[model samples]
Target: MATPVLSAERLAASYTYHAYRQLIDDLQAEGKTTGPQQSELLTNYTRLNVQRMHRLDKTVQLLPELREALAALRKPYVWLIITEGWCGDAAQIVPVLEAVAQASAGNITTHFLLRDDNLDLMDQYLTAGGRSIPKLVVLDAATLTEVANWGPRPATAQQMFLDLKSQDLPFEEFSTQLHGWYAKDKTQSTQRELLALLKSL
Candidate 1:
């Protein structure tokens, strides 16, 4: 058979909705007020780093292999993203998951769970078992059983992209770093390594 053409994802359109803009505003508020010079540094960081998650084409270019890794998965994956609106990680990964959802007949469902509003839900993840904000709970939607997870820090791919972009490394190198982190077995080590590795991406 001929290679299949990828169709456009509708939810993907709504995925980046006003929610992301609100995140940008929140992110600004969360930052400590700095002198004009120091503020300029962060401005550059965000300007250089503000990840517009809605643009599918640009995101893929930022990390082609990572996108493929997500594309390879079969979904119906319930992605409960426990996050604060101000978090940079949420800004990055939510869009990637949205794109993945767009690709696979909506196999992925991206739910943004605000940390302050959903204490019970978050406490479950933030506990020893629970983890932190931007924790991606990838589960079997039907059974409500978890399958796999990635996040809190490396939770959002846009953050990773910014890290990679800052280093000015090519996409292949970024993919190499990410997969290496995923390959680790211990949870604590896995989380730490992934965060460190993404920072290097």
Candidate 2:
């Protein structure tokens, strides 16, 4: 039998239930189940909050490129998931990532980093204009050097910024985009680069 490729949907679902389970446990432990304080917050379903119990249930399916991403990452990898508990993007991407890690079996060790919790480490990347949560920083497990980084920022910009001082690089329009990042490319270039990086590895 051939091994199955871990789809993003499955990952999302796994993460959802896992997160929900924790929430439930916490609520029970704290006995704080009331109004919006607990109910609304509980309903917010984090990145790992909900999973389709039945396969037939209609849910957001994984995009093709994203599926390709899981395949790109080989075994024995280290993944740093730097994210905020409330960031929408983090909730959106975590499940897919979890699914990928799960499918890979013992090949990957995922380290979840809450941005607020790791201010010191985040400070390094902050200089590179990394102010957002859920940055999936992929690095070499052996050397501890960054293989590449992916998140809310452009791959080229992030890579360049990591490799050189901010002043050395021509802080061009990609520069201007940070102020209005919505106008920038849809991260397709970044994803493509990630794919290439994985293939090279």
TM-score of each: 0.46, 0.50
Question: Which 10-residue span in candidate 1 carries the lowest summed lDDT?
Answer: 2-11
Q: Which candidate has the top score in TM-score?
A: 2
The candidate that achieves the highest lDDT relative to the unseen native structure: 2
What would you estimate as the lDDT of candidate 1?
0.48
Q: Report the number of backbone clashes for model 1.
A: 7
Computed on alpha carbons, the lDDT of every model, listed in order, comes to 0.48, 0.49
Model 1 stretches astray by more than 4 angstroms: 1-58, 61-75, 127-131, 155-201
115 Cα displacement, candidate 2 (Å): 0.7
Q: Model 2, range 1-201, lDDT digits (tens) per residue?
A: 322222333333322435533554465455442123344444443322223111112333444665566656655766666664444444444544555556555556566655655566566565346566557766565544566666754556556435544456554443344423312433344445545545666
Q: Tell me how far the alpha carbon of residue 151 in candidate 2 is from the true structure, in angstroms, after superposition.
A: 0.3
Listing every candidate in turn, what is its Cα RMSD in Å to the true structure after a full C-alpha superposition? Answer: 12.9, 11.3
